[model samples]
Every structure is written in C-alpha cells, then in structure tokens.
Target chain A: MIIQREAVLLFAGLAVVLAVATAIGWTLKRFLAEGAPHPTIDNLNARINAWWVMVVVIGLGAALGRTALVVLFALVSFFALREFLTLAPTRRGDHLALSFAFFFVLPVQYYLVAIEWYGLFAIFVPVYVFLALPILAALRSDITRFLERTAVVQWGVMISVYCISHVPALLMLQIPRYEGRSLLLVLFLLAVVQASDVLQYVCGKLFGRRKVAPQLSPSKTLAGLVGGAASAIALGAALGRLTPFGVVGAAGIAAVIVAMGFLGGLVMSAIKRDLGVKDWGAMIEGHGGMLDRLDSVCFAAPVFFHLTRYFYT
Target chain B: MRLLPQLLGKAVTGLMRLLTGAQARWVGCGPAPTQRIYFANHTSHGDFVLIWTCLPPSLRAMTRPVAGADYWLAGGLRRYLITNVLNGVLIDRDKATRTRDPIEVILAALGEGWSLIVFPEGTRNVGAELLPFRSGIYHVARQRPEVELVPVWIDNLNRVLPKGDVLPVPLLCSATFGTPTRLREGEGKDAFLARLCRAILALRPA
Candidate 1:
C-alpha cells in the first residue's frame, strides 16, 4: 500500500512534467514551422518526446522499489557496455575476457549490490575483476595491442557497469533517518544530472558562442555549462525534502554532481572521438544509446554515492 | 506446442539481438518476401542466430538456418534450439555420409517455401579474413536458381563469441546484407565463390 501510494505520487509528478514539456514542445514546433523547419527546434521536440518515454520508464522502475530498480539499472549497464564495446577495437583474443565481463563480472557486481555486500560491491570490478580480465585476455596469447585492448574493456566495465551501478547502490545506503526513502536519492541524482544535460542543451542552443572543446564535443559551450549548472543546482536545492540534505547542502551537492556530470560527458565524448564513432548506437531516438543518456550520470553517481555514504551513512 | 516454439524463438532471438547488439543493415537490397539463401561468413557459433534474428519478424518465420547436424545434434539443448526454436535444417557435414546430399535437404526445405541461411565457410574461422568458401553455396545456387543468394557480412561476432568459447561476451555485432547475386551461365565455381566472398566483404564498414 505504501509502495502503491509512492508509485501514484511519482507517476502524478511525472505526468505533470510531461504535460508541461509537451506544451512547450508543441508551441515551439508551431512557432518554428513558419519559415523553414528549424533543425534545432525539431531536435528539441524529439528530445522532449524521448524524455517523456524515459521518465515514465524510469519513474515506474523507481516506484517498484529496490529489486526492479536494480534490474532496470542492470539492463542499462548491459546496453551501455554493449554500445561501448561495439565501437571499441576489440580482438578475438579479448573474447573470453569480454564474455566474463558481460555475463559474469557485470552481473556479479550488480548481484553484490542487490545482496547489499557493500565491501565486495565497491571493489569487485575495480580491484578483483580488473586484475582477472587482463589475465583472461593474456591466455589467448595474442600480444598485438594487448595493453590497449585490455584497457578498453577494463575502462568500459569501470565506466558503464561499476559507475552506473552506484546509482542503484544508493538504495542500499544506510543513511540515518533516510530509511524507506533512498529511492528518492536515486531520483535526485538522476533529476539533477538529466536536468543539467537538458538545460545545458537549451542554453547552448540559445546563447552559445564559445566552444568548450570543439574537437571533443562541438555542442558543449561555456555559457551552457554555467547556466545549466546553476539551474540544476536550484532544482536540486528545491528537491532537498526528498533527501537528508538541507537546501544549502543539496545545492552544494547538486553543484558537485553537475560539475562531475559535465566532465563525464566530455570524457565520454573524447572516448567516442578516439573510437571515431558517432552517438554509440541508435537505440534511443535523438539520444543515441543508453551510454549517451547516462554519460553524465556515470561520473556523478560514484561521487554522489561516496558523498552520501561518508557523510550521511 | 507450435505456439510454444514460436514464443521461445521470439524470446531467443530477442535475447540474441540484445546480447550481440546485432544491427541488420540492408545495404544493397531491401528485405523482400521472396525466398532467399542468406549466406554469411562464419566466425562464431552465433553467426546464424545473429543473422536470423536480424531479419524482420515476418521474414524470420520463413528463414531457416542450414547448420551442421554434428554440432547442433550433439547436445539436447542445442538440438532443441536448432530444430524447434530456430527451425534449423541440420545438414550432415561429414562427407562419410553419402546417404542424403546436404544440398538436396536444403532444396527440399526450400521447396516448402522457406528461405535457407547457409554459412559458405562451412566451419567457423578464428581470424578476420574469410576462409575460402566451400562448394556447398555453388551447388545450392545451382539447385535453387530462382532463390535469391544474399551475401551477409556478420562483423564482430568472432569477438562476441569466438570459436571454442561457450559464454558469449556482449559485443556489438552487425549483419550487413548485400545485393543478391545469381550464378551466371559461364561463371566457374571458384569465380562464383570469390564473387560471393567479395560481396559480403564489401558490406563491412571501413
């Protein structure tokens, strides 16, 4: 009954958000269709439609509580890892190790988190799995770019699985007075990260002139970064009732998340540039893939997790 | 009983698509309802399944993979997967069995209006380079002259589930179907095979 009530409230909130976004998108479409079809407005409308779908899906998962939410994030990690490895230059020698990473290592890491084995969950992929995978690749006896190949797989697992897992792992945190409400922390992180992304895109399109890193990500701009971070921080502060953090604390934390998320997006963009592929895979319309959606979240999750664990827990 | 296998087939194909992330790219020709022989380079055991799953659901029902009987029939699970789930036509790859010709079996399956998927490589290769295609494709093309022979290049499957590996790693694999080629009146066996190989290879992303 409590879970049902929570689900109802979350769904209601999401419906309201979607309604407002849809209205804005419709108005923009109508206004921008006068002369020539504006590509930016069309893309924005597409992104808003995608956000509606993404929000409903994630909101349902969050409302379902621990197990379903964990499963949802696991699937996200699975697809994100798939997108990363799809473009990454992998050899036949890396097959066994990669198999272990996807089927065994990724699942086991999430399983540890599900079972609340905090110690193992923290170190499983980074320390144990990291050392084990390179050895698995070495057994194939293909030394051609062995280091690069192994590093690609290792970094992919770390970013996609290890980092993304922390969002749901937030549900496992034993924060004082935060019982039965850790799901909100997950939502908080998602909202801030996503809001930062959306806001950044909007700001960049409106008033962007100076490029952040033209070679890495042509879309990101300095004006977008400042405005988006400020907006996300404000939203985070307003949502402080959901967490143990007060308004000012939530603002500080939100700023940290936004900054880290920005860096994460940049880093992922750099990796994509190095790999010479655009947008990972075309799973999500306008967003590319699961990794593209979660790039900022990947960097912010670990930091938010550790911060929550150290201070609140 | 029939519905069960269909459901299982859908589930298996869905899982295969998710795990392999196999994107079906129709490069040279769009998908048609006509009977076809989708031949691809074999790298991993998952080649046929990846190619089969990439087909539109309407086409999936009619497309059956021509697999080696020795491999698929060895295990009970594999046997069920090949026969029931995939609706595979298992051919005895062993040359010792002179009883029924593998091409005749494929042709019989084709006679029933089902498209056949054949791996011209016969066996899985461990490298990026394609092994010289065997004579089976040439024979099949000769037998089913009306059926379209589409060359599919299945890239990155070797890294996803390489030879001798049971557990498949979740890597991005793609099945790129090229333009259908037909056997010419004067083309030699080696020339036809080489052309088929070239067609498949051309679909690979640079």
Candidate 2:
C-alpha cells in the first residue's frame, strides 16, 4: 500500500498538535509548577509524553503497510488480555483454555483480519472462541464457581481481543470512492475518542464538582461529560475530511463514539472495582495498563467499524 | 567460543521476563552486589528463573539456581539449558545413586563466588498453604554464616505456568526481595528453617 497523501496530511497535523501539547506541558512545568508539588501538571506531562510514544508506534505500523498494523494490534490484544486476566480469578482448571486463548485465538483472529476474510474474522471470536473455552475449562472438572470463572474468561477475550481487533479490521473495509482511505477512518475514530478523554480530564479539573458515578469511577463528572463531549464532537466535525462522513455526519458519529467510549471506561472501572485493583497493570506511566489506555477504543472501534461498513461500504 | 552460551543466556532471560513480567520489588533491600543466597517457595519450575531475571545483570552472571537433577538432567536439551544457558546447579534428589553430597556441592558453588537460589519447600505445593521446608537451607546457611539469606516471594508465577502446562500465559508476575537475615550463632536447625519459612511467606502480596 503506497503512502496515501491524505494519510500523510493527517499524520502531519497530529504531529503538530502533539508538539504544541508538549510545549504547553513543558512551559507549565518549567515555570508555573517549578519547585512545587503539582501532581496534576506532572501527570499531564506524563500523559502527553505517552501520547508521543503511542503516535510514533502507530505511525511506524502504518508505514509498514497492512500486515504490520495487524501484527501491532495483535500484540496490543495480547498485552491487554494479559492485564485483564491477571486480576481475574483463573484457577488451575482454566490453564489449558487460557493458553489456547493466548496462543491460538489471538493470532488467528488478527490473521483473518489481515487477509480481509470478513466472514471468518467477524464470527471467529464471538462464535468460535466463546463456545470452545468453556468446554476446555470444564474438561478439568473444577466445578467451584465454574460458571463465574468461564464467564470472566469469555468477557476478557471479548473485550480485549474481539473488540479491540476491530480497529485493524477497519482497514479491510472496501468503501467505494473512499478507496485507500479507510486508514483515515481509523484516524478519525482514534482522534475523537482520545480527544474526548483528554478534554474530559481537563474539564474535570477545571469545573467538575458533582461526581458522575462515585462508585464506579470517581474522576468522571457531569460537567466533564457535557464540556468534553461537546468539544470532541466539534473536533470531529473539523476532522470531517478524514472520514467519508460530512461535517454533520462526522459530529453525529463522534457523539456515538463519545457515549460508547464513556460507558466503556465505566464498565472497565467496574471490573477493576470488583477485582479490587487501582490499575489493570503497571505497563505504562500515568496510564495504568495497556487495557486502561485501550478501554475506550475497545468499545468505540467495533461500533464505528460496523457503522462504516453497513452504510458507507 | 563463549558467545553462543552468553547469547543463549540473554535470550533465555529475555523470554522469561517476557512470559512473566519478572518485575523485582526491592522492598527490604536494594539489589546490592553481594554474595548472598536467595531462598524462595517452590511452586513452578520457573520460580528461580523469575528470581534470576529479577536480579541486576551484574548479579545475574554470578547467580545459580539449584534445580533437581532428575528434572534438569532428564534430556540432552534440559542438560544444555540448565548448565549452559541458565548457569544452574543440578543437585541429585535420590541419595542412592549420588556420589557427592548435595550440600557439599552447594557449598562449593558458594566458594566459587556464586550466589544460589534455593527452594526450601523441597517440592511444588499445588495447594494454597506452603509445604514443610526441607532442611538444606538450614545446613547451607549454618555453614556459611557470612552469607545473608534474602527471602524472595515469587508471586503469580505458579499461576503463570502451573504444573503440567506446556505454555505460559502472559500474566504479570513479581518477585519481591525482603530484608536479609543470617543464621545466628546458636540457632537450631528447626528454628532456623522455620524462621526463613516465615520470612518468605510474609512477603506474599496482600
């Protein structure tokens, strides 16, 4: 796949925005927050730095063509699943099934995506993996909390591998007239979701008072939702060129992405609360884990992919 | 000449770190470069590998894991991996066919300026509670009173690659090093082993 002109423009625009963010973070730290214990500013800088690393990684993957991007997301699913199952109650009985999930299910799902086998990749995890793993676990006959254990394993593969795999699966869509530009659809989804996250965090700090759900996620607030989601929707409209969707369509889709991404974070937070962990795993700085960073993407990607395929393709 | 073994050493350590996070928490003491014995609970065969990978590379070269000869010497590949790649010390479990005393061989490794990773639990404990510790740790510590015994708790490795599982699931695992204790001058064998056992179990993640 040749380097599309639109993709290059999108990348350059993202790089400029990241550079500006880095400049702001450095200025705030070097002058305003110097010699003082400012956790928020430090955390903001750390988050910006992590974003730099992530952009570089995704850029490199896109540069290498279709196979590289699929492989990269395969690794992403692998790490995210590892973090999810770490806090889960997987006993000795679940070993075989768990190994199969890691070794067999993960790579094959991504392989199907890479080859653009829409039929197999679509139902592979939801149909095949969902049914097989429980049988494997039941073979060991460890009947203590059997249903709960198998359900957690199913939920883990669904969220981590099946859901997250849809990001790369976006590349396989053959949208008419938007040929060779489905990569931009990926860019749009990521931009809207991540922008919503950063905006929500900033809005929460500035004007948030009433906690949205103090039980599940303490940091989320009503003001953050309205302020952040509204801004991200506008950002999506501005990024309308990337998607086949025009300005209004872009904003409408961005609204869907924001709502799904918000609920996705809450669902993951509930799982963390149930498991009694502050973070999924300490894989990234300022970000809790691979799953923590990808939780919103995990929910947004599948919905965005299906929407694009059903209407646009 | 030595390049192949050295490369193999780094590769094995890298793979172990990748499979298990092999994250080292220096809770009690820093990973200071010193000739000390690290005694931990026996659960997975990967126990010592995790601990070995947790150590600083400068220390990893001089650290040797004490593995059972029956397991490590079972095949030609196992022999090559244990002796060449991992730099492990294979101790005989059966006394009938053994010529040299296992304790004496361990002491000889110490004399060669090598720190050892010993499992005091003798065998893998499939259950939640720790098994009764073997007396080898007491004897090794008693003879080398100068060596500090650092109790390491290997968390989640057993779950990472449990018994009879061929492949390890990529789970986050940690090896926590605790405060070093030494065998006192008048400490009895049972008392010394019991103390070390408690020290190891104390570092279990709450």
Candidate 3:
C-alpha cells in the first residue's frame, strides 16, 4: 500500500516536472526558431533532447530503487571522467595516477556517499586524491612536463571524479518531511541547474545586449547570466520542500549554485580554450562535451552537498 | 544485454566521430567478390579503425583481421573485443618452435568467403619508409591464388594517431586502394612480398 502511494506520488511528480520541462523546451523551441544562431540553437535543442532521455532513465531508475539510481550516477561520472582525460594531455608517468583516479578514487567517493559518510565524502577528493595523485605521478621520475602533467591529472580527478560524484551523494541525505523524497531533491537540483543553462541560451539569443567576457567566452552574455540565474533561483525556492529548506533558504542555496555554476562554466571554458578545441568530446551531438554538460554540476554538486549536510545533518 | 552492447557500440562510435570529425570517403568500394586479401602498411593504431570504419557495413560482417595473438589475446576484454567486436583472427607470431600454420588459418578464413586485412610489414614503423616485408603475405597469397590481392596504402595514419597513444588527435587520414595484384606463376616469396610492399608505397602522395 505504501509502495502504491509512493508510485502515485512519483508519477504525479514526474508528470508535473516533465510537463513544465516540455513547456519550457517548447517555448525555447519556438523562440530559437524565430532568430537564433542556427547551429548553436540546433545544438541547444539536441542537448535538451539528450537531457530528456537521461532524465527519463534516471527517473525510472530512482523509482525502481535507490541503489539503481546511485549506480546510474556512478556510470555517468565514469563517462564524464573518461571524456575529460581523453582530451587532457597525459603521459606514461601519469598512467598509474590516471588509473587510480578512475578505478579507486571514483568508486570510493561514491561509496562514501552511498553509506552516508558525509564528512569524509566531502573532503576525500580535495584533500586526499589531490595529494596522492601527484605523488604517484612523480614516482615515475620522468619529469619532462612533471608539474604540468601532475596538475592536469589532479585537476581532471577533482573536477570529473571528486566534484561531480557529489550530485549522487545527495541521495544519502535524510531530510525531515521529505523521507524517501531524495529523488525529488535530485530532480530539483538538476531541473534548476539544467534550466539555468537552457534559459541562459534562450536569453542570450533573445536579448543578449552585453557580452559577459568577450575574450574568454563569446557565447556568454551578462544579460543571459542574470536572467538565467534569476529564473533558477525562483524555481529553486519554489521547490524548497524537495530539500530540508523553506522558500527563503532554498533561494539562498540556489543563488550559491548559480554563482558556482557560472564560475565552473567559465573555468572549464577557459581550459577548453587553452587546449584550442571547441568541445571536449562529441558524445552528445548538440552539447560540446561531457565537461560542457557537467561543468555546472562540478560546482553545483559540492556546494549543494555541503550546504545540505551542514544544516540538515 | 544485446541492446546495451549495441547502444555502447553506437555511443563509442559516436564519441570517436565527435573527437575526430568524420571525414570518410567511399569513392572506390570495389565490387562484391568471393574473397580478397587486403595488404596495407601500418603506421599508427588508426590503421585498423580507419579501414574497418571505411568498409561497408555488410562487407564488415565477413571481414576478419589477422592481429598479433600476443597482444590481442592477452586478456578477456581484449579477446572479446577482437573476436566479437572486430571479428578478428588472432595469429601467434613469437613461437620459438614450429606451431600451427598461420597460412592455414588465414586460408580457412578466406575459404569461408571472408576477406582479411594483413599488415605485411609485420610491425609498426615509426618512420615513413615501409618496413621490410615478411614471408607471411607471400605464403597466404600462394595458398589462396584465387583470391584478389588488393594492396592498400594508408597515408598520414601515423600523424593522426601515433602508436602507443591512448588519445587520438583529429587529423585527416586517407586509405588509398591500389590496383589489385596477384602472384605470378613461379614467383619467389621475397620478390612477391617486395612487389606487394612497393605497390602500397607507390600509392603514397609525394
């Protein structure tokens, strides 16, 4: 009987979310059709389509069981890490460090979250993985590009493995009044973060009067950033019950995520720009790379994870 | 299970195309025939992928590659990928004593109406000059005189993705299909192998 009630709630929750997403997507679809950069607009639509598929898959997994959902997120982190390293300049000396980062650190980070080891989960990547990887790389003694290579591996490990894993770590939270509603929290975070990206693209196309960083990232605009971040905060507060937060608290958290997400996107864009490439890898047609999709999550995940743990836990 | 593997395949192929923009050309797909032995000079790891990705999907089904058994058969994942994903025929090249005949294995694959890709240089060369041809190509061709011996020249593969590198940087590579040649009656093994090597070298752009 409880399962049936949960099922009905989940279905209702999903229908509402999907309907809203579709409406927003439809609005953007119509808006893009009017007068947008043809290629980037097409790419944005394709990214939205891919998001729809990913959301459905994860949603179904969550409805099935918590473990399934955790495992799905784990696989996504693995792919994102793979995409990151595939582009990063690597050396033979970095192989062991890279392997350890992928096989050990990634699994352990998620396992910590899965078991609700909050404190260790929060610091594992930044503190431990960051220190250990360079030591392993330096052990090779082929110090040609030693500092640069170690930094590259360390950065990839942090951004791809350690940071992104926190999003799934959200599942282990035990929020009051939201027992077994962790999936909804996941949805809320994803919806706000992804909606921000989609809306930023929409606004950038519609009324991007001022450039945010003409040299750094030409696509980003100050107008788009403000508009998108505002909408995300508004949506975040509206879905505050999804977390252990009230409306005002939720807005505060969303504001943090928006700022962090912008920084994350900028930093990753700078990295790609330095590497002299457009996209990280072409896994998704419209989206640039795995890093491109996960850039916002890299920043948003850790902040959200820590905030929820600090107050709720 | 099947659907998952198919999706993985598509995802992997898509990833490859994404990293390296798809710049494939199918100008000369040569008519469907019973069997043909493709001999090409290998410069990089991209040689196999370039050739395999270039062939028609239908023809790829029956085509098998002669990969070094020591490397391809090293572990379960590699074995599964070579035999299942790529449908390769592994050959042991480091036997100190006489073992199972390699020619018989390749002949059997061709006899089953499967086309095979062979690297006559036997090993990857870091330089532009074609490595010395091995006797394996002559032996395989001598046994299957009926099969068309097509000499393929893969240019700029080494520059696209060098050997022993995990990441493949995007660069244009062209696989030139030279006119098919066959072993003449009473031709010596060294002469035939050299001619085959030269036929491939002839196709490289100046």
TM-score of every candidate: 0.90, 0.96, 0.71
Which is superior by DockQ, 2 or 3? Answer: 2
Q: For residues B1-206, could you state the per-residue lDDT of candidate 1 as single tens digits?
A: 39888788878888887787778899989989989999888888888889888998899888899999999999999998898888889889888875788889988998999998898888988777889888988987887778889988988877776667677777778899999889988789999999998988888888
**Fraction of the native A-B contacts that model 3 recovers:** 0.00
Candidate 1 segments exceeding 4 Å error: A1-11, A26-42, A139-141, B1-4, B184-190
Question: Interface root mean square deviation of every model, in Å?
Answer: 1.3, 0.5, 7.7
Q: What are the fnat scores of the candidates, in the order listed?
A: 1.00, 1.00, 0.00
lDDT winner, 1 or 2: 2
- TM-score of candidate 3 restricted to chain B? 0.87
lDDT tens digits, residue span A1-313, model 3: 4443554565577567666756766676677566555665566567667766766776677677777877777777776776677667776667668767777888898888678787898788889988998898888787888989888888887888788777778878887766776666676677778778877877887789899987768999988998988988998897775566889998998888888888888898899888877777666657866678879988888888888878976
Find the 10 residues in a row with the least total lDDT in model 2 chain B: B13-22
Tens-digit lDDT track of model 1 for A1-313:
5545654675687689779978877887787675357887777777788888898889778766789999999999999998888888888788888778888988998899899999999999889999999999999999999999999999999998999999999988987866777887888899899999989988887898899889999999989988888999999998887678998889999999999999999999999988888788888877888889999999999999999889888
Model 2, position A9: C-alpha lDDT score: 78
DockQ values, each candidate: 0.71, 0.90, 0.12
Candidate 3 on B1-206: residue-level lDDT in tens? 26655555456456555434433433334635547777889876556666666566666666778888887888997777676677788787876743777777777788788998899888888886888998987887787787888777775556445566565543335567767778999999888988888888777756
Q: A184-252, model 2: which lDDT tens digit per residue?
A: 887788889999998998898889999999999999999998899999999999998778888989999
C-alpha lDDT of all candidate models, in order: 0.87, 0.90, 0.74
- In angstroms, how far off is B54's CA in candidate 2? 1.8
Candidate 1 chain B least-lDDT 10 residues: B160-169
